[model samples]
Target: MDYNKVKEGISLLLEGLGVDCNDPHFKESPERVARAWTDELCIGLKEETFHLTTFPMTSGDQPNMIILQHIPVKSICAHHLLPFIGEATVAYIPQKSLCGLSKLSRVVDFFARRPQVQEHLTSDIAQYFQHKLNPQGVGVIIKASHLCMEMRGVKHSGLMTTSALLGCFLKNSTVRAEFMALARLQ
Candidate 1:
């Protein structure tokens, strides 16, 4: 993250908008906003934050769907740079391995900290587990309230939902339905 560059850019932006950057209330705003963006909003762009660990499943264990729901997500909108706050529901049917339950939340946060569209965010997370864990199936759903929509344009406030299904979740109706039921998307 280029902290200095972001701070300078923000200061110049404020100046260009006729906001006095030297005023006491606004003096440190540029630095603060830059830090907030780098540390909180766009942290997921860093590759180091995406490590997910998986454990081998026993041969005799039944292949089953695992669902993790309502994992909190806060992401910046790629179009507006404003925040979209949401919850993600991720489900996977293990092929030969399973990850820690908490790892699902970490995965959600890792992808959420980047500037993204809800649709892309949904697919990214689903594909990630599908590739890394080689799950039999993966499903991801996100429901968000975008600040750009709530605070700009028509100023309407409503949740936007997006979902992605892969592997068995995409090919098998029964498997997809079970995941949706567990996620309360039915």
Candidate 2:
């Protein structure tokens, strides 16, 4: 993305919102926001590579669920241009392939950097694993706080939104329940 152009746009937007650009506190806000977008808030732009490998089945040929829980997620809502901060829980039953434990978190980070809806984001991660890993099943759940809702619109600060994608998880009640139970664990 064009960082300079974005910085300029933020400056213009702040000016339009009647924020004093010359004020000491506000003068550097635009640039700082732009840097945050390019670095932290939008780091998914750099995650274009998906490294996959085939590993020998070490789980004794039993298709056990692999769950990664409470992965911190932060993204911008496409509709409101506001922050959506949350935690994601993902699970998949490997068929004959498996990915590194950390790779799952990287995949989550990859999609979270873009502006998106929570529903779409949840489904995208599940779909990616299903398609790429060809797993027996994939599940994704996200619970997030949208700044758009908390700061404006209804202004309900305590409201949290949840979205989930259940592929094989839905077809099998036991698997679905297990995934949910693992996700809720502290």
Candidate 3:
């Protein structure tokens, strides 16, 4: 992230908006915004920010549906560059391996930290597991309330829901039903 560029741009923006850049309260605002935006936009894009680990499924272990719900997500909407805060429910059936339980939440956070649309974010989370673990099926659902929608035009509170179903979750009704049933338990 180019902190200096962002700082300069913010100063220019404030000046254009007729906000006094020399005001005491506004003096460090540019630097503060730039520093805060670094975590919101840049940190998650790094490859090492979150490392996923999977455990091999044993011979006797059953390939059951594993669902983690209420995983909090905070993200910047690509369209408006505003915030959307929500919870996600992720479910997967392991064919050969299982990801750590806590990593499920981490995965949601990992993807949500970037500027995104809820649809693509849902698909990305499911696809990442599909690519990495080669799971039997993956299902991801996110429910978010976008600040852009409420704080801008329309100015009404609403929750946006999006989901991505892959493999068996896409091909089999039974698996999809089971995942939804468990995931909606909250």
Candidate 4:
């Protein structure tokens, strides 16, 4: 990432808005904002895709639904360039492999670090697991408060929910219901 260019752009933006960077309080603001964006906010732009570690399922291991609930979801909105903060629930029914538990949360963080819409984030996470594990089903749910909606558009604040379901999560009602129950969306 060209940190200097980002800093320059930020400075230009501030100056365009009539804020002088020479002002003591705002002197370091451009660099600070650039660092915030590069080092933290948009890390998905820099990091490689999360490597999901998998192990074969044993005959004795039951093929049951595995769920990780309330994993932190943080992302910048694609349209407004603001942030959406929430938690995500990722669940899947194993076919023959199990993903490393921590990798599930990593998946959420991996996809959520980019500028994205909640619906796309949910679907992408589900697709990653479904493609990686070849799971019998994958379901993802995100409940978030978008700063775009809450702070700007209508000035309302509430968690907006979105979901993506695949495989049996879409084809089987019983499976879907159980997954939804786990997400508290039933």
| lDDT tens readout by residue for model 3, 8-61 | 887788889998868998888778777777756655765564568999999998
Please list the C-alpha lDDT of all candidates, in the order they appear. Answer: 0.90, 0.84, 0.88, 0.91
Model 2 root-mean-square deviation:
2.3
Clashes of 2: 0
Instruction: Please give the TM-score that candidate 3 achieves against the real structure.
Output: 0.93
**Comparing 1 and 4 on TM-score, the stronger one:** 1
- The TM-score that candidate 2 achieves is 0.86
Cα-lDDT of candidate 1: 0.90
Q: Over all chains combined, what TM-score does candidate 4 have?
A: 0.93
lDDT by residue (33-148, candidate 2, tens digit) is 88998878877776677565556677577789999987989899999999899888888988888888888888888899988888888888888888888888998888888999
How much is 96 displaced in model 1, in angstroms?
Answer: 0.6
Question: Which is the leading candidate under TM-score?
Answer: 1
- For model 1, how does the per-residue alpha-carbon lDDT over 1-186 read when each residue is reduced to its tens digit? 688898888889889999887799998889898998888788887667467798999878788888988899999899998999989999999999999999999999998888889999999999999999999999999999999999999899999999999999999999988888899953
RMSD of each: 1.6, 2.3, 1.5, 1.7
Give the residue spans of candidate 4 off by over 4 A. 1-4
lDDT against true structure, model 4: 0.91
